[model samples]
Target chain A: MSVLVYAENADGKFKKSVFEAVSYARAIADQNNTTLTAISIGNVAADELSALGQYGAHKILNVSTDKLKNFINQAYASVIAKASEAEQADVVVISNTFSGRGLAPRVAVKLGAGIADGAVSLPDTGNGKFLIKKTAFSGKAFATVELTSANKVIALIPNSYKVIENATGAKPEDFTVETNESDFKALLKEIVKSTDKVSLPDAEIVVSAGRGLKGPENWGMIEELADLLGAATACSKPVSDAGWRPHSEHVGQTGIAVSPNLYIAIGISGAIQHLAGISSSKVIVVINKDPEAPFYKVADYGIVGDAFEIVPKLIEAVKTYKASA
Target chain B: MNILVCISNVPDTTTKVTFNANNTQFNTAGVQFIINPYDEIALARAIELTDGGKGAVTVIHVGEAANEPTIRKALAIGATDAVRVNAPAHDAYFVAVQIAEYVKQHPFDLILTGRESIDYNGSKVAAMLGELLDIPSVSIIKKLDVDGANGTVEREIEGGKEVLTIPLPFVAGTAEGVAEPKIPNMRGIMSARTKPLTVVEPVEVKASSEIISYETPAPRGQVKLIPADDVAKLVDLLHNEAKVI
Candidate 1:
């Protein structure tokens, strides 16, 4: 029995999360005394898939299917399920992404295995049972889960685990799996991508604004700061509801849940619902005019001033710092 | 079009979380439970869809007798009937298995639920149930529109949104943009008293994952005060101490 990792690829290149998932699966395979193999689908190149060896993938299973170029849940699940059976994989790893979120549980059901999504750490094998810790309550707390079944599926939360690069020269082997088109019921007719510069979930640094920004037209300062820092721009739920920003950029319990490395809140009061979404960040900096804003209670750093005046200075400082660095 | 909407009774978002003596279970004392915000969107969407066509909306819950109030709340909102799988929610996997088992007996044209429960925050149930039923599933859906034979759903991706079309009998996890949940009207609230609410014993669920313990997050650090005029000092602190800049 070996560990199989579903390496995610977009437009033929492996995503950054794939390397992290490979690093995680490598550790699990080492503990279990099993080989760690990766499966690549769609238009991915053999050489590119093989290059994942730097992340500890012993071998890559290259399944090149033209129909699998775009994500169709049913087809992808069937392909991964077939690959798992072929490799006799006892443990399967996937990234907790939009695609993974849609496919991981389906694959788990196909394998009749126990699934743990939003996993934050590797499994603890010291005890007789293998237990994985996952973030629950939207990163408010962690829950240690024991996967007692024979087959287990885990979806590692993105950007949570550090990627270990060994630069080991591992080769990719070409493997083919036949998939029937009938299994794919849902069709991805088109993909409409937002023109946002940075993705909130993948952004290491996020600059978020709230109602204090006054109006959507006055968001230029926040955007400038985020642009200079190379960070994603976010808004509070109220801002989104008021049409200051798109609902996709709303960060709160009712909005998009995010856990970036550095989250900078501007003019947000830190309601419990909003805090529940972003409280998992490594460092939190709150900028508000009110000295008694609740966001300061949870912030690692705080600036008690108007966002309009403070944000421009922050932007200039970050620009100077980036230039110097 | 028979729509199935699943609702989970979870602590209100404002509730401060605390653990029991052993930290194996969540402390429910002094905590107010409500219909999950995400599931409320699902319920509203189901009601709207059924109201547009010749269909009925049914709400289902897998919990003990204590959860009946929340079930009644769903019925009071707009659901025509309700089903309570009389069992304590064991875990995400166990609960999914039980829901899938119950769903098999009653086929639904569309299945809707919240993206994740506020308490457990496990977003895997919809996909798991879809897999068990061998149907397509989408999560984090903000917009949903259904025709007689086909349906369209818009799900939020990392940087963008994906608009996909699938046939009927698909699953969708409701997020914010689906629709604002409407408070039950006086007519609906009174009518809910007569709606059918059937509670069935839960089937045997194979539990694979067990919670070991729980711990609260680290306490908030002391807040620092900086004069409004000393913007440079604030920047220095951010650059040097906080290192976020």
Candidate 2:
């Protein structure tokens, strides 16, 4: 009868997507005339779970088990299923990140619920039917789906909903659950984390280079601009395939999908695939030598010139503005 | 090791999406179908894992009879056999239920699928299957290595990546950079016909979600042209009109 949200964390800190998921869950709870409760896994402290009260979580369920520190899908799913069963949660909400994408569906199956991923908005429950709108075709279009089942699971698309914060306080109870033996056929042995200073997906501003940067060696300007703006660096798929950038930094349909507030494309022609991954950004700035480049078609702003000469000036301007402000 | 890879038949990435007159269903006329790109990665990883000749790789598809060609393509890609549940590919939960039924009958050491299907972008099937099987699952895995009885997986996070090690019999959704997808060789293609493909009727699980309608994205506006030589003016336009800087 109530909405349950999965609050994700990394290294004991809450991820920004947790707020977004809570926001969506709050709306669902309001519609259902029930309170929203959040569940935290891994090493999240009670204070951290209580902080979610600002996002309209009336109560928080903290499943703080030592074995749940790292994400084991089976273990995490088991805990969530147990919580859902105990709470009798009709609606489940999660962020559409790696963990949620992997865990939400499985949880839905266990609950025998209908699932909607990449949901951009809250469901319409006014007509006695639950209809949710989600982005499909890599964010190209929208699909209105009606969940006919009694239980429903939704994975909210990141950055699509506004995170609502209210002045509220609540003390959450610590709930401990028993995890059974791992049933995964594949066992995880170790974790190797990249030490990059700027991670593209989490960056508010992203400076991306494309083939127009000429080669990998000429990436000084792009890096300089990114450094000046305090932004993460990304590249188009072609640039990644050509070895100009690491495969992890590729931002396109075939690569990582990003929705930063500001996306700056340097020396890149906009292919449809590349556009699909980045079109959801709040603002798009395209820099290409060709005025007729396809990227300009979707760009809110364009700089038609050599990136080598233009990037430096832009960097200088940003520095001057920051210094003055 | 018995690796089970799930493949979905979807419209090619470049296909022009269209809707019916009533906007109730996608226009399927003349649309070419191909193996879901992400699923291809899962299939490739499974084949590579089994290529050492220790275990076998099997591909499964839950779709109509017309999807057999796509299922055979997985065999051609190097799976030992294929299975097709004869049912209209319904919602994500429905499809997951069908696959779970089949998987329960034939247990696997590993299950792999694409992070999400390109067409629906549901991103739910692998997780749903994991829940149904009561197993561990990981999504958007970029790097994976398996040793004797242990597997290490790297998943992409918002700003960084997470590395975890677990035992076998887990589900993983493959994204790019996990492994290069393999093309079917002529020999494999020729031998695919001889491979076993089991067809079974779908279970009585119902779809929880119903598609109300499908619509194409609005056509992109015309391109704005700026003279290439006027870099300064272009910068000003970007700052004032575009407001991106």
On TM-score, the leading prediction is 1
Error of 2 at B232 (Å): 8.0
lDDT of 1 at B66: 95
lDDT per residue, candidate 2, B1-245, as tens digits?
A: 89899999988766767778698878889988999999999888888888878789989899999888898888998999999989988877777888889889999888898988888888788877777777677888887777876677888776567777756777788888777889999999999999999999999977688889776545545545555455555446545665655
**Candidate 1's C-alpha lDDT?**
0.85
| lDDT, model 2, position B26 | 82
Best by DockQ: 1
In model 1, state the lDDT of residue A39. Answer: 91
* lDDT of candidate 2 at residue A305, scale 0 to 100: 83
True-vs-predicted CA distance for residue A225, candidate 1, Å: 0.8
C-alpha lDDT (0 to 100) for residue B203 of candidate 2: 91
Residue B236 in model 1: lDDT: 75
Candidate 2 lDDT, tens digit per residue, A1-325? 8889999887788867788889789889999899888898888777787888988898888887666777766677778877887888999998887777877877777787888888877998877989998877775567889988898888887778888995358677777887677543435555555765667766777999998888999888888878877788999988988877888898876677788878889988888778877877877888888888889888866778888877776776666665764
Compared with the true structure, all predictions reach lDDT values of 0.85, 0.80
